[model samples]
Target: MRIGILGTGNMADALATHWARAGHQVVVGGRDLAKARRLADRIGHRTGAGDLRTAAEHAEVALLAVPFGAAAALAGTLRDALAGRTLIDCTNPVGPGFRLLTAHGPSAAEQVAAAAPEALVVKAFNLCHENVWRMDPPVFDGRPLAVPLCTDHPAALALASHLTRDLGCTPLAAGPLGNAALLEATAALFITLWVGQHADAQAVAPPLSHAAGPA
Candidate 1:
């Protein structure tokens, strides 16, 4: 699949790298042309420029990897171009410095859908950190890392699962788009726990798990 990521941050770059390594064409777009070019060159895939519209316009699947607040802004900007396309949302709607902001209510995915009603918005990849995604995406224990996915479109959800598997993580369909609230809340919990671990200087979560227990 031709994957276009909307952010040039570590998360976007990590997905681009892994997707390119998996033999998929990946392109990155950001406010900084130089940064997008640099990441595209490093990934060794076809590169392009322009605003979010241009990036999302030409790709088969567009990954909304921008910051939480920025995601809705960018989606609003790309509203016309995103129609009829599958949008994989990886943003966490956290408050300042990754605090809970929008997870308790409608969730970031639903917000994106509301902002871009024509697009098929699916929630995925918000639970784990970018470092874990870049370095250790595979599960260490018996269970696969739980990357809960919620989407109303079956085709889009399947594509997300395929991409998740390609990137070395197991995908669990948490339900339809409305279930995004649960996933988003789970992401907040993960981030909170992550902060706690870093504060205590203990071992972080080895990988992700799809088990029934905690995040």
Candidate 2:
């Protein structure tokens, strides 16, 4: 798979490393060409660097790793280049106090979709810190990390799921794009618990057997 990463930040670097190592072609792009080149160099072989539009136009899948505040505008700018492409949105619009910045409006994913109407927008990878993604396979307690994805497009879902597995993580189908707000809100709550409360957010949920009643 050819993957385009639209940022030179931590998430972009972390996720692209896994994909590139898995034999996928990767293009790291950013507003600053030098930063993109540096990131590509750090990722080593099979990865290249380019401008944002060039990256978006060169790949079948594009990952938007830009800041949440800038994502919509960036998506609008790349609308034509991203048409009919699967765009992965890993942004979390959490403000101070770990509140959902988009509390009263569409989710970060929705805003990106509205900006690039022709693109298949998928919400994923927003639930964990980039450091967690940097872990080799992100396993904990003997279980591989589980990624929940929300997307309306079948192909987009499949691609996201494949990438999750590429990192040795399980992908949980969290429903369609309409449910993305739920995912974003969940992220906000989990971040608050993880950071402010210094709690293990995972403990807030019961095991599947328990949640499924007397199964």
TM-score of 1: 0.86
Computed on alpha carbons, the lDDT of every model, listed in order, comes to: 0.80, 0.95
Candidate 1 lDDT by residue in tens digits, 1-215:
87778988888878878888888867688888888888788877455544556679877789998888888878888988888889999987777665678744687888899999999899998877787788645575655565788999998988899998987788899899998888777666666666855442224344336334585
* Model 2 misplaced regions, further than 4 Å: none
Candidate No. with top TM-score? 2
In candidate 1, list every pair of residues with a backbone clash. 95-99, 145-208, 145-209, 146-209
Model 1 scores a C-alpha lDDT of: 0.80
- Over the stretch 53-152, how does candidate 2's per-residue lDDT look in tens digits? 9899987999999999999999999999999999999999999889899999999999999999999999999999999999998999999999999999
Off by over 4 Å in 1: 47-50, 197-215
Model 1 lDDT at residue 30: 80
